[model samples]
Target: MAVYTHVPAEVLDALLTRYAVGTLVSAKGIAEGVENSNYLVETTKGRFILTLYEKRVAAADLPFFMALLDHLSAAGCPVPRAIPARDGTQIQTVAGRPACLIEFLSGVSPTTPTAAQAGAAGAALARMHLALADFTGARPNSLGIAGWHQLAANCGDALDRIAPGLGGRVADELAWLDAHWPAALPQSVIHADLFPDNVLMLGDAVTGVIDFYFACTEVRAWDLAVAHAAWCFDPGGTRFDPALSAAMIGGYEAALPLSDAERAALPALARGACLRFLLTRAWDWLNTPADALVTRKDPLAFLNRLDAYAGGGLL
Candidate 1:
């Protein structure tokens, strides 16, 4: 059974009443993410995902995330479309947390995604990026440099236990990033976390993407690098899938070709992406409160990725 932050039936009923959707038949937690509390809500009309924004997501940024989905969906992107409330608001306060209902995308995340499937994911992501090219809204990078620093500070005490020298490594990486980070890359809305878990597929075809909580405005190449980290690395981290990376890049380049500078910086950007996930996973492992209903992701999985990038050379 999955851990669920219980929502009383009465409150759920009231929430449903505020929407055009029918009465809720049942609700259960969707146990895949570490950030927000998600529930699979079945209504007489259809199934939907009820997301209760957690601490990591700022309330102010909810509009951008929601609007981005709407924009993307309008432009034929395979992302969940927000179900507007009777009051026409895309988001609402529920149980003291900002909450909203989204049309549940039908598909499962491929556990062992093939190169073709990865290529499809890359294509879908590129389409999403192009669709939102004209979007002018601004949202902070939730998992960018600033958040990395804060996470390290919060989990400073646990570094020795989780991973030795992680603290110093984080400091050094931060310094290196501050000095060498691209200042004039092509900026756009990026789905900062494009991991396999966030992508859904039906058979070999890509279906939809979820977990836009980390979406923000940033370098497009950084987004590509993050996708590479997720698609290229196996769980054990000993294996490398060059074909998968190539397929993904091929699909993306088909939609939006990378600039020479973007390609040049991809190696370092991939390294930075690796470290970002490593630090967050470590912090979550150590600092997730005992009573919190969240699973701690493996920090070593990302550490292994960092190691691979070090030797594999990001060409």
Candidate 2:
């Protein structure tokens, strides 16, 4: 349903000629993603995900994403590998968009994650960080503070339409983050978006960490903060689960202990993470076309998280 471009059958068949992945049997549009058109592609050899990078994804960044996936997969992290074409390039053009076939990984994304699942996800995240510690690739987080400011400006008065006083609250939060955000902490390639949907789990073990489009080089613990904002609360952000939070941190620490500075910066980082989502969701709410296939996420869900993070102690 999130498909933005429809790839015709003949075009798909022609594209399959570049890969030795066997002739395409079927290709069904995947409904779960927002930024790219994805398909559950079946071939004579095996099943794979064919992603046609949409407008939001920059063509220049494709190589960085491919390299990151290759690095993580080779490091034994539970991530999908970008299947190279017979020409040895992972990137190609399909439906007039940059595309790649990814090795299919098995598992379901938990709808309502248990503490054990949260713990497993946290450990998997830490492993990804550790594995990418030596990766030479670098990409800036475009949705960082500067991008948040741009979104706030783009939203303008619409923020109040979403919820009263949201614009003011976002402005205040941005100023606070600019002053307080951690600067000297350890840095690495991080999966900036690690929501429940991005992680695929089998029971309590993580089978895959998919959707690395938002991946970037940033403070390592801020990645933990992003996960904390995403996984430690109920879907509506109405209830906090201290046990789940503790378990997540415990699992992460078990894999790679957090530094003292990282520990000290968690609260602010969590607040920044919350604001990042709140701003983006607000922008999307106001801008997405009425007939768009993707669901319009309620920006207020993260506004609740921003408020909770402001109160302190949730982390």
Candidate 3:
């Protein structure tokens, strides 16, 4: 989703030679996300995304990510399918990194998604969870509660560098989350990261969902909690709009009704979701090089959300 490694023309061509995706016309670096090296490559066959796994995206986990996409596509999710090479391999080595070619999905990510779009995003997510219920694989959520401490420790006191009391507040919040996080709530293969940019919209409908690198086995309703944090928060991350939150949850409930326990546990789960992003963003903000070809999302935005959630600004 970001461009840390540049793909030289010959490197790309040599890889494409093994596939029938045709001659590479152009490969433009996608400059949106902070995870991996992504390019919008146009070829004689069609357009596709070439992702070179970068930091944090382990080479061992590549099979899980690829297989999940294949599974979701087979189950009729509106996600791009992995394109295998002529020799029947789905992944290839490129730029000395694990690489794969995925069909380019149509539509654009909405900059300011509407309420209807939020609803559709929820519905689409519900459908995906239902379809993935049969998947037998298990991948631990590296960003789940068990992983938060290391991330905060990785940030160390640098979190306080972002703000005077940010480190102490993050520590306190993580401890509370570790103790009170929900235990049982209809678990399934949940899309742990469903931020707006990861969804492609054609009008109010979701044409595709990308970036399954963060997907893992977790509480089913936790997906909705992640969506609420992503879609309902304001740009400044200063406020959480109840109307937007309601529409999103309402949309999900339409497909799968929330249990009484799930309903009672949602606010805390949402607060946890916000903390996951807040810490990760804060870590990336401090570590990534400024001249890198990617946008480092503002960790302060989530800091504001942490304050909002702590102060009962989010319902």
The best candidate in terms of lDDT: 2
TM-score quality measure for candidate 3: 0.97
Give the CA lDDT, 0 to 100, for residue 196 in model 2. Answer: 92
lDDT of 2 by residue, 200-247 (tens): 989998999999999998888999999999999998888889988998
For all candidates, the clash counts are 0, 0, 0
TM-score, every prediction: 0.94, 0.97, 0.97
What are the lDDT figures for the candidates, one per model?
0.82, 0.90, 0.87
Compose the digit string of candidate 1's lDDT tens values, residues 209-269: 8788888889888998999988887875567788888988998888888899998888778
Candidate 3 shows a clash count of 0
- TM-score of candidate 1 against the unseen true structure: 0.94
lDDT of 3 by residue, 47-143 (tens): 9999988978898888887888889899999988779899898877888888889989999888887889999898889889888989987788888
Error of 3 at 206 (Å): 0.7
Candidate 2, residue 27: Cα displacement in angstroms equals 1.7
C-alpha positional error of residue 203 in candidate 2 after TM-score superposition, expressed in Å:
0.7
RMSD of 1: 1.8
**Per-prediction RMSD in angstroms?**
1.8, 1.1, 1.2
